[model samples]
Target: MGQRVAYYRRRRGYSQAVLSGLVGRSEEWLSQIERGARDIDRLSTILEVAKALRIVPQRLLPGPFHTTPRQTQQSGTIGTAPDVVPDIETAMLRYDGIAGLVGITDPGPVNLGHLERQVELSFVCSQTEQWSRMAPLVPGMIADSYHASRQAVTDAEKRRAKTLEALVYRVTSGMLDRLGEPRLPWVAAERSMAAAEMTEDPLLIAGGAWRLAVVLRHSGRLTESTDVPTAAADALRRDDRNATPEHLSVYGSLMLKGAVGAASVNDHSAVRDYLSEVERTAERLGSDRNDFWFAFGPTNVSIHRVWLALELGDPSQAIDLADAVPLDQLPPELAERRVSHLITVAWAYYLRRRYREALDALTEARMAAPEQLIFTGRVHTMLSGMLRRERRSIKHDLRELSEFVGVAG
Candidate 1:
């Protein structure tokens, strides 16, 4: 381990003092680390060293260690979707490996058409919350797309391959975010943005920007989160005439995301402006369409209305708006969104002191997307809040639901 640390430090031209200062460790501590005299067992420290060296943490380990499938099944709290934990770990490892991004020996003339279909399938898997099904497919897809891009003889073919790679990374970022793994999602989002730039496609770049904003929002950088989507929306608005349905869908989704960030910070005016813009865009689009897998349009816009209202402390209005929407009409591919909406509805009901209705909504959310509801912080918060209402009597069903979701009864 010490030798590996020394090797990476030298490879990056980082002296002990420089690397130590960057990671906020003493030079002596770093020296001890590099000399095998210090035993570094903390995952956080290992990750920090890897970040300083501009490499994956696994790179510093003696040999690559992977969590077995059985181990993932046993480690329930690590991710809400336990079935996808192994796949998420595998995909992260592949992202860490240089070989996955740039294949050796040209991959011998891959077919871009076949690769495109695989990428589409992966996107569907991600959207539908089919984590167990999607987990085994992503790492190979990323490698194949990279290989295809490298071996392409024409600019068009190369661009197509890179675009597919960008989409794959976008899906990867979404899955990692769902698992609540912070740093890996940022890595995937950045990779998606880089590949999108390589393609020089505005729509794809907007998609990347959307992913980055989501990562920022998840990381609680609310101001930067709002800024990223706001800038992307501005760029998209400038190219409206030539914009396809996909472009408008991405643009509208960005507007909604910016509103989410704005609402988080109590910027009511910004939230209203962004939501209004999305409403206009949705009106232009005419209906809900899952363009670029975003599921953006009128129905989605309404859903975000509920989300924003709840964030802004108007739970009654949120419930009213949520009731006005035809949530059942949402496409089956949008299971995660439906789950989120149901949870939001439950939260609103809880706020109104309607415990039975809240329990029913929460139960429906679990039925719609068990993994998502289990993993969602909002659901846990709502349930815990309900449980803590000492004056109100909690029902047996609510108690069961709370226990099922691993909340205190």
Candidate 2:
């Protein structure tokens, strides 16, 4: 730990005095820490040091620490190897594993009840940004759900099982996107769409479509991305009269995804249309709800407004809209949204050339969800861009941020 701190500090060109000043510690104390004479056993202190360094807490710790009891229990069986940072090929292998599992499994009786619980667990993992913990479990869950769907005795049972299967793939797509794997998310999206279609559930189909659009948008297939959610939103609009919260949530989420896709391609008109649609849906929903794990509601709508503003080159407007977001209304369990909010704040600050403020925002984002921020490409890119443009104006913390995110300064 001391070695790591010293290495990162030196890598960022920070003197001991400068690093200690940022962390609110004396140079001698920092020296002791760096010299392996002081222990950093407290999680809070470690987190504080990491935050000051603009790095994730995990980066300061020894490898493969257990974050949950379940993870600890599974550790022995899962092997003691440290968590490897996932790359595009790692993401691809996950998809391949899923496909291989599906192909090799015979259509046999499956415990749908157990599989349903696993699905719920997987969703929790996704929501909480437990990427390393979740990656190993998804392929098996998908295979189990697929087998259950295949062997179901009735249509309702089949639909339920297949819906779970589709959701697993949807979660995989989301996880891959969060992990900075550009193209592999598309593979998961395609699998999700196929599984959703097999379920014959309109809501499931919409969910899958939005996931596809999200991956496409991230991969720069802006036109196809916009087309996907637009068509899904059109089909879903036909049932607007009797829409449930889940229905509205999925619909609104799709619209938001479409808005992003449009903004990506500078389709201002389409962007406005999509944002307007989501705003209206937000009004109907009235407040935040994580229906279908979409986290759709007025608060989320406001956040997207900020996101869209940032996308459209209006950082001031984005910051203003962000100020209107009811942070208290955002559920604590929605770590992904919170991390995203902070990331957007960081982007807005960066756009304004407020480098210190931007670094602070990103630091807060890493503190909020270190696992998510560490794996996010956008966060690293933002840090890199800021360092590239403002090298002379850079502070020690920003230099540390650049090193933390692997950006050459």
Candidate 3:
């Protein structure tokens, strides 16, 4: 509110260039941040800055988080809990503008919150009576979520950021595999500008950038994503501060980027090496029990590795890693990861014509997240398609299928 943030940074004897490098931003970006041209994204960044300048969040928060949420609590559902946004789904339906997310100002980075809304709305829109209407907005919605996240800088804001980030990853890397489109991760990369400027913590800033790299890789921008992680890693090395779980999670994400890239290029050599690197990253960050953010440990990265193997058509490798997953231990926030992955495994079996096995996996997945995060429409949307593909593909047993998808045979 009062240029107090800049005041503190300056009093600490750090110039824009000095802090920007530490946070993986350019001095120019920092200049803009001080001038209010940019938005802050990561809470860790905010916290870091507070410490660096011997201040706390209250100093820069012109107005701190709302004493109450913008919206009142809608009753949650039984399985996945609350289901009140029946119309929130419609707002997504109504948001038909396809101009695409411009991301934040200055560099126009991809916005994490924008992408997340994309995933949620897309999944919902995938069920649209005219699915096409919902299609174009997916990318832009994702972009806007990232924009919202770019300026996010508190536990409250991080909740919003990670929620959006997770949704985008689920839809693109997890659920919506049929639509072959390149996801733009410009938001994730640029959004970290806020993360860095607000926090003054290299690890925090790099973590935001690392998320962008993984998103980029997931979106098929392998080369750019491949090259990005090192920026963050380099920053982390330079900062040489004590490792926080959030920081390690950022590093873990970079390792995932390598794994995703190697798999995308079909380079098993690179893939294995990156997989090892991810494990090492997770191990190194093992002591970080910070709960919600960046809690994606070795198992989390391992899950991605299996997906990468699946993408590479190595089911044996997939099964091997799948066997070792401890789905129960993950944070509640990662419930969707388990949800979508279960669907993938079952669908994989179905693709292989292993009907019974496929049905079994479907049952397990249904048990994992029964309420359909938002669009139960898709599960049923495809059942008819599956039956049409082979009326008898599931010739013998339909009970599991019916129960799993909640459809009557």
TM-score of each: 0.75, 0.73, 0.50
lDDT computed for candidate 2: 0.73
Query: In model 2, how large is the Cα lDDT of residue 180?
Result: 54
Error of 3 at 254 (Å): 2.0
Please give the distance, in angstroms, between residue 59's alpha carbon in candidate 2 and its true position after superposition.
28
True-structure Cα RMSD, model 2: 12.5
lDDT of 2 by residue, 228-253 (tens): 99899899999999999889999999
In terms of TM-score, which candidate is stronger, 1 or 2?
1
Q: Mind giving the per-residue lDDT tens digits that candidate 3 earns over 3-60?
A: 6667877788888777777667678877866764443422335545565566655465
Task: Give the best candidate by TM-score.
Answer: 1
Q: Which regions of candidate 1 deviate over 4 angstroms?
A: 1-97, 100-111, 387-394
Question: Cα RMSD to native, each candidate?
Answer: 11.5, 12.5, 20.5
Sorted on lDDT, highest at the top, how do the candidates line up?
1, 2, 3
Q: Return the candidate ranking by TM-score, descending.
A: 1, 2, 3
Q: Model 1 residue 136 lDDT?
A: 65
Residues 36-98 of candidate 1 have per-residue lDDT tens digits of 444453334666788889987657643311222211242232222455555656655654446
- Give me the candidate number with maximum lDDT: 1
